[model samples]
Target: MQHKHGISPRMEHYSCMVTLLGRAGKLDDAYDIINQMPFEPDGCIWGSLLGSCRVHGNVVLAEPENASNYVLLSNIYAYKKMWDGVNRLRDMMKTVGLKKEKGCSWIEIKNKVHMLLAGDSSNPMMAAITEKQ
Candidate 1:
């Protein structure tokens, strides 16, 4: 696409390339590309690698030593329905003193906005919601 459009590669370009290559199971290639980057790789780059690792069911790349990567790995594992991986990530976070933020959601009904927080029982429909779920 770049060649056809006469566009030059940039950080965004490299990031997308790394993500695609990692998703395709070319981890070494992705890692090489990341290493070649002039600046330090950030959380986004690590997230791409960790997501790909989870998709491929390869936990080796999700080691807890890399905290940022571990967070992404945990999210990916959660999406992939891997309870064990999620639990491992939770444990790692606890051990490292990384507090996992509580999840929250908001909904609007009859022009009124309702908010829900993890473990909060303030909602009037809390009983119904819990029963349904």
Candidate 2:
């Protein structure tokens, strides 16, 4: 379709293809696409591929230093109840001092913006919120 429209494939396009292929259990095809891309695959591309691998229970891909990549892989291992894999990933992160950045989100309620962070418990109302939830 891109060729028909004369729109050259970009990194995002290749990444999408990899993701689709991975989700379809066509991991080999996805890997081949990554290898055959005209340009170097960026972290996003690799991350997508890794996510697919996690879903499909394949861990043959190379590990990148990106914290998010490790997090996704660790989650995958955890999903499969593979404590060894999870511990190994955790150890690697600790050895390299690679910490995943805390994610934050904000919401506006009645003209007031409230901020929240992943695993954040600093808020004074956290206990109340937790009890309510």
> Which candidate tops TM-score?
2
Clashes of each: 0, 0
Clashing pairs in 2: none
TM-score of 2: 0.70
Provide the TM-score for each candidate, comma-separated: 0.55, 0.70
CA lDDT scores, all candidates in order: 0.76, 0.83
List model 2 lDDT by residue over 1-133, tens digit each.
Answer: 6768988999988989998998998888998999999899898788888888888888676365599889988988888899999999999999999998887777665677777788888976556445643
Report RMSD for candidate 1.
8.1
Clashing pairs in 1: none
Alpha-carbon shift of residue 119 in model 2 (angstroms)? 9.4
Highest lDDT model number: 2
RMSD for all candidates, in order, please. 8.1, 6.0
